[model samples]
Each structure stands twice: as C-alpha cells, then as structure tokens.
Target: MIGTSEIILIFGIVIFWIPVILLIYLSIRYLINRSKKVHEEKTALDILKERYAKGEITKEEFEEIKKTLDSA
Candidate 1:
C-alpha cells in the first residue's frame, strides 16, 4: 500500500517534469522556424544574384536591391 506522502511525492515528480518536456518541445520548434527563415533569405538572395547576372536588372537596380538585402 502507498502512503499519502509517497503519492504526493510521485505527483510532484510528474509535475516537475512537465515544464522540462515543454521547454524541449518549444526549443526544437524555435530552431526549426529559425532555420526556415534563414533558408528563405538565402534563397531570395540567390534569386536576386541570378537575376542581376542575367541582366534582368541594371547595375544601379542591382546595387540598390543588394543594399536592401544586406540591411535586412
């Protein structure tokens, strides 16, 4: 048979672990979101560079756009 004190101890342990589990889940989610944002920015920069190389943008336009991306 379990005493009341032992039952309380068990409950405390469970409660203590819940926040740890939530922190790990949130950390993973944050990393994934950060990685996705970085990938999006890299892709945008690559596209801009390609367009400039193809002469789709004039030198002044490319410089202005590149400056904007750099600032971001």
Candidate 2:
C-alpha cells in the first residue's frame, strides 16, 4: 500500500503538469483562431479591392467599404 507522502507526491506531479498542458492547448487554439481571422480579413479586402478596380464601386464607396472592413 502507498503511504500518505507517496500519494501527495503523485498529486503534486499531476498538479504541476496540468497547467502546462492547458497552456499548450490554449496557445494552439488561439493560433488557429487568429490565422482564420487573418485569412478572412485578407480575403474580404481582396474582394473589395477587386470590385473597386473593376469599376463596380466608386472610389468614395470603395474607401468607405475599406474603412468598414478594416474596423472589423
């Protein structure tokens, strides 16, 4: 049978590593989310610029739309 001190040692090891594991997981998730956001922003800006270049929107309208997208 394990003594009290042995159980405490095991618990301490687990407690110490739990936060490390959680931090790694959170960092990965944050990176993935940030990448998706950047890609979407780039795509939206590209579309807006394309429309402006094609003369679908006036220069003033393009500027306003660009400002809105950038604010997002």
Candidate 3:
C-alpha cells in the first residue's frame, strides 16, 4: 500500500532523527562520565585528608599528594 514517496519520507525522517538521537546519547554519556570523575576525585581527597588527620602522612607529603590529586 505504500508508494515511493511514503518510503522516501520514512527514510528522510529516520535520517533526520538519527544524529539527534546519537547527540542526546553522547551528551548523557559525557555527563555521567564527568560526574563519576568528580565523585572519584572527592573520594580521593577525603581519603587524603583522613590520612593527614590520622598522622599517617606529613603535612608536606599531604600537600604534594593533594596537588597531584587536584591536577588530575
């Protein structure tokens, strides 16, 4: 029952929406990755602070480690 025009229209719609769908997917993925990185950085910083508080590392050592962590 479908004509050539109908087939072309369906293909056209799909082509138009494919990139939009991909873009949305990529954006969500990027945001999730960014948030995860931030969480990991915070966790590392917390652990470093805890170590410093516990006297496991010297002040200079803590400062060096913190600088490395923040840079990453």
Candidate 4:
C-alpha cells in the first residue's frame, strides 16, 4: 500500500515534470512553426522573377519594376 509520503513525493515529481514537458513541447512546436514560416515566405524579387519567367510581364516592365524596387 502507498503511504502519504510516497503519494506526496509522486505528486511533486509529476508536478515538476508537467512544466518540463510543456516547455519542451512548446519549444519544439515554436521551432517547427518558425521553420515553416521561413520556408513559406517569399521575397518580392522572387515573385517578380517568377512572373517574368511566366511571360506575364514584358522585359521593359520587369526592368522598370525592378528599378523601382531597388530604389525603394
């Protein structure tokens, strides 16, 4: 049979680990989300290049926009 002291000790251990586990889980989740955000984010120049490659914009327009972006 479990005694009061053992029960208290078990409860204390569980209480201690709860926060430790939560911190680790949160850290991992934060890192994963941070990495996903980085991967999904795209620069304006990258989008411009994609559009130019698709022939959606003329070379002159591409150069004009690129110049505006560079100056800004």
Q: In TM-score terms, which candidate is top?
A: 4
Model 3: what TM-score? 0.58
Worst window of 10 by summed lDDT in candidate 2: 38-47
Clashing pairs in 1: none
Overall lDDT per candidate, in order of appearance: 0.92, 0.94, 0.96, 0.97
Model 3 agreement with the true structure over 1-72: per-residue lDDT tens digits? 999999999999999999999999999999999999987765888899999999999999999999999999
RMSD to the native, candidate 2? 6.4
lDDT of 1 by residue, 1-72 (tens): 999999999999999999999999999999999999987775667889899899999989988988998999
Summarize candidate 2's per-residue lDDT along 13-38 as a digit string, tens digits: 99999999999999999999999998
How does model 4 fare in lDDT? 0.97
Q: How does model 2 score by TM-score?
A: 0.59
lDDT agreement of model 2 with the native: 0.94
Residue-by-residue lDDT tens digits, candidate 4, 2-72? 99999999999999999999999999999999999999988899999999999999999999999999999
RMSD of candidate 3 to the true fold? 6.0
Ranking by TM-score: 4, 2, 3, 1
Candidate 4 ranges with C-alpha deviation above 4 Å:
35-40
Which candidate has the top score in lDDT? 4
TM-scores of all candidate predictions against the true structure? 0.57, 0.59, 0.58, 0.70
